[model samples]
Target: MVTVILTMNLSARFTVQGSGFQSSRREKYGNVFKTHLLGRPLIRVTGAENVRKILMGEHHLVSTEWPRSTRMLLGPNTVANSIGDIHRNKRKVFSKIFSHEALESYLPKIQLVIQDTLRAWSSHPEAINVYQEAQKLTFRMAIRVLLGFSIPEEDLGHLFEVYQQFVENVFSLPVDLPFSGYRRGIQARQTLQKGLEKAIREKLQCTQGKDYSDALDILIESSKEHGKEMTMQELKDGTLELIFAAYATTASASTSLIMQLLKHPAEVMRLFTPISGGYRTVLQTFELDGFQIPKGWSVMYSIRDTHDTAPVFKDVNVFDPDRFGQARSEDKDGRFHYLPFGGGVRTCLGKHLAKLFLKVLAVELASTSRFELATRTFPRITLVPVLHPVDGLSVKFFGLDSNQNKILPETEAMLSATV
Candidate 1:
């Protein structure tokens, strides 16, 4: 057993060394010895059964150590590090704000924010860094949708810098040195906490009925109901925790989606073509060729590998949205195969909202503009706290002609009906 473990550890190390992304590590290892690792079983997850069990049955068995790296940045009791009934209660409270009704109410506001961000991009040089733009859009959305306030540009810049520092240290060696990234992350947490405390205090004094109807309202109301209202410190940490959760994941996924589309022009055109069948194809292509994730692992699903797996996709590596449209029934069993937001009980609570946000943004961008990758060479993929194209996704966006800008009445009607 020791020899088997040791060999597996060495193999895993070599695999990771060869591919910075975990999905690539799994692909390199194939189905052999999926278990075994070095260090404390930091995130010991395997197989779909194991994943389901941990995520659903014995979830508490898994520690929130992964987020401890951000504890200083997010408060200790922030939802990410929260456990047991408290976590569940908090989730329940927040769920109300994320419901379809709540989201629909916020749709017009969301559309306005997205449009403004896109308009800003329109005036810039044609080849814009889409990764950066996506981050900005998501960041702005988080503030407006969850915090109920618009962050000033200067404050947004400072906050993002601190956030970036904290994210960079999430997997760093568990040591704090003067001026090191981990130490900086700890300091950043302190700054964020102070800001959050002030905000919570202000919210506490507001007329109850006049409170902003964002996630903050839900959290405050829930805390009050339990007679365990968040203290200034708790409020600060919790807010940051929520923002980080929504921001980083969405930003990363959106960036990856765009990159995938750009890499396959045919798929991009097919995806945007006006056809009921084409829409489904875009969804499938997004699933396959986007990521490969192991069934039972509790880690973030690898959209890249899940998108490229041979068993789930015909030419898993190649971008082909048609597969999704034509093969929906065939891919039914593979629904859980491409979980960009994770799966089971722990699946992203904000998934529907995220999808709505993505769909609307995609509709707006594809319909009103023509865009393409400006670079001929594939940019190196970098894991900068989140996956990003190393060179940044520079693309030229051409505004649609007046006639081309005419909304597809059916599509507009569909979106409105959903709203």
Candidate 2:
């Protein structure tokens, strides 16, 4: 294994040229190659200490740069590309949309989405592919919450097909070779941009009201307040950027969460038990697993890694959510690990919403049915900007009795239900 000790001014790049560029390469390198792209120079980083320093550092030493492909796909003014005061201002505006009050108000809508998805899946064949289904659920939710539009079912399917192509090739070489995945992705982005521009124009003409509850509405309101409205092109780019960033990773994490729970039945039962403390217990399990990312490197934290490492918990590789019941800061080193949403200033802004969606989805699934993974071995995995099970996770769902169902309520249920 290629474990690099944390140090200052340390930088190394691992290319995907060798056969080792697959999963094993990522596992061996750990956090050291987080920022090293296929062809770019290796960015130097130590551990959490260095990650904090670089993110908080002055622009000259650790500036956020948008790769050409990302800029072309998401546009220059998107939040991912904004910097300094501009970035901070945009975050402030976006933050209001993610407030607990706002998210609470959307609970009914979220439940409706989750219920409808489960109902649809409940009727499927014994071995239904969950990866595809999860993506559909997330994409639909994005449309409802972010775009304030209800896409037709057929159109939504087509959109996912096209979006997948675009997402898969966004990091590929920019050349527009005919029939190439990169070329197809560029085309899909253009199509999405055109659609978003039309939506922005319509949103601009509407009379603002509480009923107009979507991120686009908030963005429009904020832009007007700042006297700096986005142009049609800017709106299109920014909208697509937000949708792309928010939907994929969160959905994948949720899928992984379910898989882990089902594979480890004992853990699932412990997690759902009254004594387990439900969501709090689950959160601790997520944290105890090591995500030892080094500074300067932009590595993804594999929840699987944390779940697999035995030293972190008794029978660490086993799926025992009860292990989480005993987990305390004192048990592990002082570090609070396990990063589903990453850390630092660039951490996901939609984290609150993502967690809410995942919790709701998990509750709905766990309550309504019992599911089993059909495959003996794990399916082939792929990383197209985000991780996805290439073979699609096949699962069988059996109906559950209401008495057997456990619906864990949020701490602020009284105030939120009233709101």
Candidate 3:
């Protein structure tokens, strides 16, 4: 009967976090429970020890896995679509682009992009969706950093329209039937790939022994240096993956970050990270919290649950950035307790760059202008792929001059008081 009930709710976003899952967190179903998703029976591992083991034991115990729809979205030969040695090799090459030196080089460019974008938004003088705007900002940055092209704002906006089709179809049903979302995604992928190939060709032709300091150059250089040259197809696929990751994940987080900040207006929101969950296919029969997980069974970890429940986190739903302060240090619970950036060897490689982007954007916003929420209510958010406010939280923008560091005191107080 319990299995029947769990199976019923496993579809869609319910497996990891659907409606009413929280109420059942301590319902004696145990830490690791068997459930089904997309018609396949799987294990949902909510135990801290189980999460730690699967993450830490990446190779010996289990292999990295993703839903079929997700893999189709990420494309072939990308890190997210590969496992073990292949993933490691691609990661090594990709690391060069996200390296400290690379990110440092990218700062000035990103700042320019943000400054220009915000200035454009300031001219509107009305409520605007920060979530949608942030996607454009990140998209411009992604193109510049990944493909080594500083596209003009008009061209960038146009390109986003072209890119939007691909983005809409990523997690669609994986089938080649005509007029299907998957088919549309594949077509969009081809269109984008052709564009990337053209850019790569142009970049290569103009390389007169000059270092451009971008992902394109890094990838082109690393292909030969690592003893195994990446095929042009692989490079193109990786480029797509980079662009998607840079845009999608960060956009979602930025939307959520802004909403959270608005919620806690008086507090200094210091950091934000890509909070995600993933799949681990069991290599062999395993005992997790006394539950037998069979071979080839899908085991999904819930980052939401991990951070929401205690003895792990106190006042779980409360928004308190000071938990990481020197006095509290609440993240010291255990190794796998707080995983905003995930854990284990398969942890996100772009985490450093992501952190830098978010922190810098937050600082830029605070230092530049004072903005107020257009509405007092929180926007609806969907959690299937990433957490993002559905309506793209509207904000009234107000740009400041060089001398102005803060908004009017009354305005600031009112923003908080209304919430």
Candidate 4:
């Protein structure tokens, strides 16, 4: 059985190549197949109904579980690592932070960050790497807008450096030998936690009566209001988790958004899946599509595969914005057909903020600049951890005049006018 599974997995990997591994596997093995990944037997499920069962099942049939490396690095207190009441409570506290009111408060800052970052990127003598810049941009948003930090430039740069280490190793092997990625990740996590603890202490001491609208303030206040005050350790874990959750996913999405924009100008809708899939640990033995999903095994629902194989979507590979329009309404064909933000209780808490950020970016990019791929061939996407270009997506930006016709070198006036 293991040999057959390995063969199937290898076949899937080779067949998919640049397209996607899971989608190709689905085509070969139907909507359900067992494959080993991250040192565990995983049943990879796709199709709307199959994925819907796993997603909607939540605590009853399955529970959220990332790899060992992720679990260890993210710690025990985060919403991603918790289950049952703990997850519920943490999510409740976080939901308030991403509320429409909170997002409204964050819009100006998000816009300012995007505007400034674009100007900086465009000022470069050569084409800027979209993925690299997007990472920096989202990191700034995470630090300044979400956590509301006002640290010195040196400290911010150091934090970002440490954070890159943390992110790079989150998906590494569980081995913690000295100088291993996991060991480095553990060390980086400690550094981040210390920084976050100091920030939390400063906030508590200096801003007791102040009116701040950032996520950290709201998180602290919301936790207290729930009558279950988070401990210093919990606060640190939560803050780090927020940063981790917000950083790479948004960066990857931002890059993917830009890529899609360049290819299909009218397809501004988020067809790119930043997160390839979500993981769940089976809590009970259940029959899915006549196959027994044994308890204690892992189940991975592929978001990208679901999107690809969805019969609701005509020309699934094509970027068609009209599919989402009222006349077509393809996404509405099924509950779980198009879940960029996932579904059920564990839906991404940052979905609203992410979409809003991308929307503002798209509007700003269209209004302020004319961008094109720096290279003749578009870069291929790497889908593990998150979806981003393998080459970091080199793009050159030129300023758009008031008429949105003439393209010139980006200048301060052109960038300032967009805001």
Candidate 5:
């Protein structure tokens, strides 16, 4: 099983290798069953009832777990790695920094970065790789708004290359030797951390008398609080986690959101394309809907599977966005069934920020710009860690008069209601 899974994932034609196992397995296994993946004894649980249990039962019944490559590359001190009380504290600090208030404060910075990026794109007047460009744009936001770095133009290209390699290879083999994803991720993480350490130090020294507002300032303030302070290494590890959270997943979500909006004219739609679900290591033996799941097991509640399964979503393969309308409310089939941002205490802290990022990007694209796909046919969906259109959807961009089809409020409200 490990050989089969690894062969499929590590092959030369890796980019278009999105897993279709969930669709077939849900048909055969009825949304909850044991399976082997990544050379481990694993349980793949789907459906709303089952998903609710895993996410809502976090910590007491299950604890956070990630692949070896992910754990090693991200380090142990990150909020993603901590559990129980420690996880709560780390997340609290993060929540305060990422709150709606903080988002509004950072809005000006975000607006400045995006406006400049769009203007630069306009000047090109040629086809561009939307996926790659999305990643670059999101990374710029992370650097300026989260870490407060100037990042010279000469250095930006190298910085992007390092972070790109880390994200691209984060799911590969965990071997730390040369030519391994784990090694490259480790090296890149170190390079990023060293630069962050300097930034944090300077932020602390310079912001002593003035009011501080950036994400870096929030973190530095938390680190100085008596009895609740974070250590330097913890600060650095947390920064790496922040960059990963802000840049990679948001970039992917932002890219996918635009594609969905562009295709909104079509009759069918998939509400969410989950990047990946997480593993929850069992903390004690328990029965899930009469099935015994032993302690030490690595289990994940499958988000994609639940989204595709028939019981929760009618005509699961069709692109009917209104399935989530107040009249239908298909996602309400199970209180725990629809998990776009996950569930329970461990739900993604950055979800609000990511959502806002995509919302603004969608509005900007739909309102001020007219774009045409350079490729006539739609590209295949591929999961290179995250989903991407196979060709990155090369497209030509041109400005539109701000008054055209400006996405009426009622229609926009209906679109928002769908997902």
Candidate 6:
């Protein structure tokens, strides 16, 4: 009976609502439970130890496997689509782009972009949609810094629009009928590949006898150095994948960070998990919390659910970043208790870059501008396709004086009053 209800709820989430995978069933069904998604049998695991096994079991007990639409849309060349040695080699080449030296070079660029973007936002007299603007900001950074494409502003704007179409339909039905989301996603992918191919060719032609700085150059050089030169199509596919990794989740997290800041002024919010969970396919029948997860069955280890249900946290729902600080160190109770960036071998490759980008954005916003929620009430958050406020997080930005290091006195007082 429990299995039947779980199946129905899963069906509704994917087909009808197309949003939200979280449910209160964790309390009733325990951490490990069986369900189905898109006709594939799945075991949803939530507890820290349970998730630890799933993540650490990568390539041994399970392997990465996204949805059919996702695999088709992202193509087979991406790191997420590959397995075994192929995935490892790809990760090694990709690692160079996010190495400590590369990130140091990217710091100034990230800060400058955020400063300029927030400055422009402050100049606007009316409320601005933070989620929309954050996407544009992250997209520009990904193109200019990560891919090293110095295209014109108009062209960048057009590319961002097309990319949005691709992301919007990444989780769509596999049907390829006219005007279907999957059809539109395929079209958008083709358009993006064309643009990326042109850029790759230009870079390859002009980059001889020069040191590689940006991620694309590094990827090209690293691939050749590793004795596996990527084809034009592979480079193009990989570029799109990198942009997808850097742009969407970062934007979602940035918007959520801003919302948290506005709501809980002085306190830092650590639970900005835009991605609810990750998918893996069980390689063999494994006993997890007394349930036998059969071979070939898909497994989804829940990040949000684990954080919410971890026994270490005092008030799991409350916004308490300090629990992670030196005094309490709640997350230290277990290895997988807190996973904003995930863990194990398949941990996020761009984790450092994402954190640096958010840190810079936070510093720039706090130092340069005073912002307030434009809406009377905090907007409801939606957790499909990535977490984001349903209302786009409208806010008013005001530039501070050159010497001003913080918000105005009254604004600080108002924030304190709310706290």
> Any residue pairs clashing in model 6, and if so which?
none
* Candidate 3 global lDDT: 0.69
Q: Kindly report the root-mean-square deviation of model 3 from the true structure over all alpha carbons.
A: 7.0
lDDT per residue for candidate 5 within 386-413, as digits (tens), equals 7777777787776665443232334312
Candidate 6's C-alpha runs over 4 A off are 1-6, 14-21, 208-212, 265-270, 402-419
Q: Which ten residues in a row have the lowest lDDT in candidate 6?
A: 410-419
What TM-score does structure 1 among the candidates reach? 0.75
lDDT of each: 0.55, 0.56, 0.69, 0.81, 0.71, 0.81
Write the residue-wise lDDT of candidate 4 on 1-419 in tens digits: 12124225432353237345665667777777888765667788888898889998999999999999999999988899999988898899999999999998888778877877776666666898899889888988888788877666688888999999999889887998999999999999999989988877876776543334789889989989999788999889888988887899889988988888898765533367887689999999887776778889888898877887888889977877888889989888889999988899999999999889989999888877788899999987777667778889999886665343332444323322322
lDDT of 5 at 110: 73
**lDDT (tens digit, per residue) of candidate 1 on 53-131:** 3344324333333433445545567555566676677777667768887777767667766666665565456688887
Which lDDT value does model 2 have at 27?
62
Off by over 4 Å in 5: 1-19, 208-212, 265-270, 310-312, 325-329, 401-419
TM agreement with the true structure for every prediction: 0.75, 0.74, 0.87, 0.91, 0.86, 0.90
The local lDDT score (0 to 100) that residue 53 gets in candidate 2 is 41
| Deviation in Å, model 4, residue 358 alpha carbon | 0.5
Per-residue lDDT over 1-419 for candidate 3, one digit per residue giving the tens place of the 0 to 100 score: 12212433356655245424633743556566667655567677765677898888787778887767667767778888788888888788888988988888776666655666666666665888987888887887788655766345476677687677788777666777999877888788888888777766677677554334777778767877888667778878878888887887888777766666676642222223344367888888766666666778788886666665536556766667777778887787688877777788877887787778878777777777667789877766555445556677898877787334332334312211211
Ranking by lDDT: 6, 4, 5, 3, 2, 1
lDDT (C-alpha) at residue 337 in model 6: 88
Candidate 1 local distance difference test against the native: 0.55
- Give me the displacement of residue 314 in model 1, in angstroms: 3.6
Q: Between 1 and 6, whose lDDT is larger? A: 6
Residue runs of model 2 more than 4 Å from their true location after superposition: 1-36, 44-46, 58-60, 202-212, 265-336, 401-419
Predicted structure 2: lDDT: 0.56
Each candidate's clash count: 18, 6, 0, 0, 3, 0
